[model samples]
Target chain A: MSDKPESLTQADESALMQLREEIDRLDTEILALISKRANCAMKVAEVKMKASGNAGAVFYRPEREAQVLTSVMDRNPGPLGNEDMAKLFREIMSACLALEKPMEVAYLGPEGTFTQQAALKHFGQWVKTKPMPAIDEVFREVEAGACNYGVVPVENSSEGIVNHTLDTFITSNIKICGEVELRIHHHLLAGPNTKHDKISRIYSHQQSLAQCRKWLDAHMPHAERIAVSSNAEAAKRVQGEWNSAAIAGELAASLYDLEIVESKIEDSPDNSTRFLIIGTEQVGPSSEDKTSLVVSMRNEPGALYHLLKPFNEFGVDMTRLETRPSMTGNWTYVFFIDFAGHCEDESAIKVINAIRETAVDVKVLGSYPKGVL
Target chain B: MSDKPESLTQADESALMQLREEIDRLDTEILALISKRANCAMKVAEVKMKASGNAGAVFYRPEREAQVLTSVMDRNPGPLGNEDMAKLFREIMSACLALEKPMEVAYLGPEGTFTQQAALKHFGQWVKTKPMPAIDEVFREVEAGACNYGVVPVENSSEGIVNHTLDTFITSNIKICGEVELRIHHHLLAGPNTKHDKISRIYSHQQSLAQCRKWLDAHMPHAERIAVSSNAEAAKRVQGEWNSAAIAGELAASLYDLEIVESKIEDSPDNSTRFLIIGTEQVGPSSEDKTSLVVSMRNEPGALYHLLKPFNEFGVDMTRLETRPSMTGNWTYVFFIDFAGHCEDESAIKVINAIRETAVDVKVLGSYPKGVL
Candidate 1:
């Protein structure tokens, strides 16, 4: 559409307008295609509901979505990178999925948090999201069928593991349906009432404070740094105080109608978080899948060494192992493992069997498709 | 010392007083033992200095520390679990290690963040601590030898991975020296000038807001929730306002002279975080050790499968695999893997060799001692 010759004279002015018109026409065509796709998804949902004999049916197929995302990335003839291309497709699919059955996702929230961002990034904007107070509440809502799924932060590269979520997995029967990662960026925000020059205090979550430590030390040395529960809460606090500023992300700043005094205040640009989708139904294997497990071993020397023997013997590719305190057994630690292959895979099953033989206990948290966005 | 005869009612009072005296005596004995231990560590440091021909020497031995922690847990004969026992011993060792050279450590900080807590927990109160603004700076400080060691959060169970730290690993040559875990707790606090009845807004980090969502919804539903940079920052902000309350941890509350209005506000009782110790030198194998690596492969179908083959072949207990954008490659994803056994172990070396044969590139992110606290 942008096929105008370079170094053209005034004669090309009319042609430039024509090119823009061509772009507009193509955009309309794209919208038409999207509407058609959304219709197709609704039609598919009808079939799925009929198959299950009810309205409450598993409309979100992790495997199918994963396959679609993989296909999109594989086939993209993009000027953009594969991951970015996949992300665009993910949103399109998410919108179409919403047309079929709007997803109800529960997330850890007092409105704005990284977990909420992860949820939107993974599920897209078309779905209905409810903020749950805690990680456990997110799990419980999904388990009790209040929401189709729940989003929760599982670990942070800088923070290590969320032990509460790991502990929840020990007792809950919820499945891990999908996963998403979001890059974290913190900003320094202030309210409409605040005198910027007289700003004597700063508010933020502990992580954000740590993240922006150098920036604050250099720019606002006299400002007393205060820790809060979250960035969103900090944005709210600034609304009532003129001599106060809050360090948060774009989400909280926008949510509280605060102005960014400084942007990207996070010390490290690589700050990112990962979130998991928890649901009641077991997700089928995707083209490239990952399985999570909580494995327990007897308290003895070499127990950890022995517990992991099965993966090697059975050729199962283990991905992650986290040690959390076991609740009922003298506080011995349990390992949370993520590995390649789904639970239903033949090799994965064999590995599970081998682990069960020697391990004190084992729980397959879920097998979910790898993150495509 | 607690063993006084148990049957007589009136005599039990005297026995109880005797028990109290015994506890005091035991405490003094413990202080003396700790002093002696510190002296021993100092003597070792002197000997090391002599061995190294003066000023600078490698006084911190990760392998030795890991072994000591492991032994402490193994030999613990108590109602206190292995973790509690290890934690107590961890502080003891940290104190002793500090006496050797008064270890200088840097962490993401404003003093009250969990990273700071982790630093103190890992290095003991005797060490000289500094706060870095970002995870990368923590790495840089250690790389530049400006600090003896740097502590950063690598992953969180609830939030997944801190990509910034992982990204730092991709470019920096800093070694992973040790790991520590800390349980997290959040509290709602107000300062002296705060109006308890007129708190129309609550402030916290986004994570903390989410952690306490349910409680806020029920108790202070009308209070506008705001997010901030850190919980500590929120505490400071609340001090200058009467209509605001901040949610933070105990450390933050005390640091800014705030009183806790509500305690244990987190939704999950098991909230916790993990931190990593980064230093310049490669860590030797500990009694029970773990190693981490950043592995790259040609972007292809089943690339992950091929990449993980080595761990299975060598029976190395693979623990973690995080995918991040490869710094110099064609923007394909790279995997960060953590597994049982240190880099020096024969089996671990075999796994590394096998991986090297197939991998496009591999970076040995220094092996470290497991978390003792």
Candidate 2:
């Protein structure tokens, strides 16, 4: 493919071809802008290191990220929605962050799990991500300072909450530094040797299995349904046998070089999952931010009212609140809350202090920028 | 296995055998009690049928079920925890309910998904559970009167929220009648014909794959990781293959009759998921109740603050408050909330009325009993 624009024949100069030339010119400009942004990121890293007085510097800034994304959405004059535009910028920032410092992330994984997809989505492909089998190990690796940060699924719109991640915060001091949201789409896949009509078994993760329950029952009611660790693993298994198929996502389908027998097989068209970023230090305020905390209270009338009154009085917006069985004692309960505004915000601080006054104990999980994409 | 009272010499009876006899007697007594309970349920059904003026009647009572579970916990005096005691009673209550009217439940499934286990855990095996492929279909079946209720996952503690279920509620008028929490434990499984020493591939759901990433990296670093729909499906595929293993739960391993090469292989010890029950009618007050709702507000600063002020003023304790992207429009947001009392309660009514006064629109999902098991 030659880069020279040597030909301008009459046919090549048609209106459609002329429009294509403009599109190609715009693409060239976009690439140049990206390269320039990367160089700027390197300079930004240098400034951060000089300010911190060391080569080992904290270059990632959650507040700044929030501000950037919010600004992009606020000013977008586009055919695309704010979320779509923000997603495009998200990749740009991810690449820039890689230049500043290649982030090392630990996530619950076997390479093809949704958690891994979340890691890549949040940090981009530039980060070095290690998959830990358990959520606790992700916390451990982050806790031991082996990884810069850890990613864990905190909730699913369909599934409710991941108690393990919340429970981890009860015993560990990891900060909630960022958040990611992933759209869950399941696919029915098979290997090269498989006989499509003779497929006798299908495998997938529990959530995926549930997501595709309708499709499977209609197409392969008699096939053995097996719940595996991840969709990627299922795709791998089908490779060895002729009568097996897997229901996984795009990653797994590609990871195993499998064929997609069916796509978008999940029951809900809008299935999505939210994940959290955990680290040691707390984050500051952004244009819009969310702070999470866990609070415990004794069983009594108005106990919950007492815990929430301060936020109401302080006019702090509550984003999410959930109850979990208290790990410390019987007949005791704990609540996990997420609200708009960083913990460093004045109103949030007041509400937090007020909660501490009535709560048996309170842990400020962290304040992070809202999920922009 | 003959049960006969044989002569036992003073020194002939071992402590274990003596204790076993006592346990056997208790079990017999328990069976008698259960039989009596079942008979009472039959009489209750007859009364309900008479009251309804026919043999056909709706027998499941979410409020009454909650009250019974609460009472069981209150009166429990044993070495076992309240939760443990309530679990045993949950099954008993489920059995009794079956005698009155067998319940039919729809869940996201392929037989061995966690949602299936949750359905059984909440309703007991006496109820007929139809595995539907999608969360929406579960709602559809219940709405169409094909099933008494639908059990769809609303959230997971570790995973945060299930967006599809929440969004479905936005469109469909299903009431949240009850909830169930399940502890998730994953295991490594293999078929009998597999060569244990030379495993080159692994299969599992994406989440489970991530959950066991570290273990696999350490043990089988070279094995190709594959993602699947469900662990049960993975196990099924492994049954016919010799060089593969699946990571799934105990249910899948048993259902597929696979050998457990590793048990409790998940990294986190307390990974659990929470699920919600959806039905047509709103449940009344229970011994321990939680009410869920949805409210929309205008896009403005402190929109969330205005919505929560009433709950605080009325002294209503909100158990949960989550923000959802409004399905109706851009920039507008909605909140899903769970609180301490039924909508019929005095304080809760005040809060609801106050919220209605300012909010653009509101929908009360339901008020049901807190999960006792």
Which candidate wins on TM-score?
1
Report the lDDT of model 2 for residue A230.
70
User: lDDT tens string, model 1, B1-373?
Assistant: 0121122244444543454344334333333334444455555555556545666667677776676667656665443345544554555556556556668999875444578768877875456777665789888888898999999987653344677888888888888888888777678889877767788999888877888899999889999998887776888898888899999866566556687788887888887887899988887766777888999888888888888887888888998777877878784678899998888888888888888887888889878877765
lDDT of 2 by residue, B319-346 (tens): 8888988978887888999999888898
DockQ of all models, two decimals each: 0.01, 0.01
- The single-chain TM-score for chain B of candidate 2 is 0.77
Find the candidate with the highest lDDT and give its number. 2
Report i-RMS for every model.
33.4, 35.5
Residue runs of model 2 more than 4 Å from their true location after superposition: A1-12, A24-28, A79-81, A157-159, A186-267, B1-373
Which parts of model 1 are misplaced by more than 4 Å? A1-9, A157-159, A187-267, B1-373
Instruction: For residue B147, give model 1's deviation from the true position in Å.
Output: 40
lDDT of 2 at B270: 73
